[model samples]
Target: MHRLKVQGVPLILKSIVQLLHFGYHQAMSCLFPVAIFGTLALSNVVHLPFIYRYDAILLVLLGVQYFLYRSGLETRDEIKVICLFHLIGLALELYKVHMGSWSYPEPAYTKLFGVPLYSGFMYASVASFMCQVWRRLRMDMTGWPGLASAALLGGAIYLNFFTHHFIPDVRWWLTGLVFIVFRKTWIIYRVREATYRMPLTLSFIIVGFFIWLAENISTFFNAWKYPNQHQVWHLVSFSKISSWFLLAIISVIIVAQLKYVKARRVWGD
Candidate 1:
């Protein structure tokens, strides 16, 4: 009947809309990593001015950032956040390279303290991807703690990475703290017509795993080398996943400052 046909039409149209929206977001999320991998592949093959490869990588990353903002794929606010991530990542890279945590193993005009400037852009790319996905997917959260709690934890986690070289590693303790603080937190993400949810801590681990995989790709392209890989490329040790998991906590805290919904519970309790 006409009434039944009219009712079915809205449902069909809604499904199509949701599917398209989901695909759009998925593609946007893939763009950053694809660009990085593509550039890395090309850098291996292309010949240019002495040390120009590293400079090229830096320019490519900067160009991508500019394009994203110019194209309105990233808002001014998101660009600012990505810039902050770049500085943070660069600082860590400086310290890590100084500590001999990883080696660039290549001469480059853009080298500073033996780390290429483009290394920072790798971290920025993560923020760019996360920001894009957040906007595209309409991400939301619940049960988030106060900003102080997250900032304090995130700050300590970052400092620990450097301090661990001199003192006891408290990463395990911090990991416990993350669970305690975020145990009730849930990340709500949309895909197609339905919204799905996952615990925030678990999401960190999952994201960390993927970043670890991405790390393999980066190292494959000789982005940086662990001590073990000085002679031959090898799979990054799985233990690094723990570090990525903790670093992801810091990333969430920073991104959440831009937009995160508190849970329906008393803050102090």
Candidate 2:
């Protein structure tokens, strides 16, 4: 019995070590997002001379991006992808703000069509997290759908975000399609030496929930305001999770496509 107990000690120690490694990688992957949130909170408390809070936050984020690139934390290709997400997000914010879905009450020279330019960074941060975590974890996927089908679905999901406001919300329909499309998909990731797999859909939900939590934090900092939150800051509605879930799916598809293209280029070379 003593020998058995002694042998088990290595297993326990290994488990602890792996957990620490996982946590370290996760923190590293969240650097961009942490920077964004930190800027939001800091800008709220500290006023800069002559510059509006939103504009200040944008400048800080741009500086952070430049630092990340110079530090070799983000690759050039990754930066391009992040910028693409920024454009996509900015377009959505423009439409949503126009529809009165949310309001950026703070005055800023960077405002366009009633939306702050910095607002795009919130979406770009999501792409940053996805890109960082993918590399850190050495992630890959199995049973991925065809590129055409996947892109079509992703495009549909995005269009639904706008179309829903005009027509009946087909979000649930798209959700069901997501399940069907990705039924056999699994995301394989490595932590330390061991590997694990999880359903891709499950990952979307997990990421969505976390983003919802981040949204609450952003709103608390007065980054933007929902109608209900304008009077008093409170928890964002739980139903927003569904919207984020779809957004997560879109992010994943975009990143996955980029990865696929890179891999093909490498193989061809």
Candidate 3:
């Protein structure tokens, strides 16, 4: 028994080391997101002269993006992906604010139809995270559906976000299609020589839950206000998790397609 206990020590140490490595990679992947949230929190407390808080935040985020790119933290292709997400997110923000779904409720030179320009960074950060984590984890997918099917699902998910206001919400139908589309899919990731596999849908749910938590933090920092949060800062509705979950699906599909394309190019070469 003493010899068996002694042998177990190496296994325990190995597990601890793997956990540390995982945490470190996750932190690195979250660099962009952490920067955005830090800016939001700091802008709330620190006021700069001759600049509105929102505008200042926007400038600071732009600087951060430049620094990240110049410092080689984000590659050129990743920057392009992030920019795409920024535009996509900005469009959604514009429509949602117009529909009274949410309000920025702050004055800024950078406000476009009541939505701050910095608002796009929040979405860009998600793409940034996806890119960073994918590279760090050496992630790949198996049993992926055809590109057309995947694109259709992602496009439908995005459109539903807008169309639901006018038409009956078909989010549940979309959600069902998500499961169906990814039924055979698995995400394979590596950590320090050990490999792991998780269902693609499960990864979406996990990422969505964390994003929901981040949303609560963002609202607490007065990043944006829902109808109920206008008076006082409160926890965001849990139902928002479903929205983030769908959004997560969109983000993943975009990143996955890019990776797939890159792989095809390499094979062709």
Candidate 4:
């Protein structure tokens, strides 16, 4: 027992160091989008062309995306994943904006049907952060359901976002699906040399909460406006976290597709 304790100390410290490194990279991935948005918001005081600000920000994000790949900060596979997320997000944005779910107040040369192209990056950033964290921490999962069931759940969750405006909102029903499907799912992440884990549903809530907080920051920057915010900017209602919780599930499902295909896990029964 004494010898075992002596050997465990170094392993424990190493895991802590690795966890910090993972956190740093995770933070850096999000910084790219938030920093760009914040800077452009601040630069509003400067004069620019008809399509300058929004288009310029879009171009800058594209450049950053390319640089991250070229610099090997992001893997090719991760790049593909992020791009898919961008398209998925853009499609959703187009629909939501058409439905009057949210409004992008700024005009841009890159606007398509009243949806700014840069808006896609907001969703893609979530995937980028997830991918970076997954890679850095060597994440894996236990008790994930079959792809078919997951696809059905994802479809329902997404459809609920649109259909809710007119039809009955089934989000609570889908939330039940999420709980049932992921009840046993565990997200295993490595800190350094040690592996740690939490329930996948809990991770969904935690990530959703942070995204909700980020939404507050984004709204404060006037990235988009909710109906209530049109009159006064207030803290986004916590109720939105339930919506973000659903979106986070979609993001995780997309990233998990790649992770599931590429990596075989030891935990699945």
Give per-residue CA lDDT, model 3, range 30-124, as digits (tens).
99899989998998898788899899989989999999999999999899999999999999999999999999988999999999999999999
For lDDT, candidate 3 versus 4, the one ahead is 3
- As a whole number from 0 to 100, the lDDT of residue 156 in candidate 4 is 87
Report the number of clashing residue pairs per model. Answer: 0, 0, 0, 0
Model 4 agreement with the true structure over 94-172: per-residue lDDT tens digits: 9999998889777777999888898888888888888988887788888998799888899889888878889999888
Off by over 4 Å in 1: 1-23, 49-51, 260-269
Please state every model's RMSD to the true fold in angstroms: 5.1, 1.2, 1.0, 4.2
Scored by lDDT, model 2 comes in at 0.95
lDDT of each: 0.86, 0.95, 0.94, 0.84
Give the best candidate by lDDT: 2
TM-scores for all candidates: the values are 0.87, 0.97, 0.98, 0.87
lDDT of 4: 0.84
Clashes by residue pair, model 4: none
Error of 1 at 255 (Å): 0.7
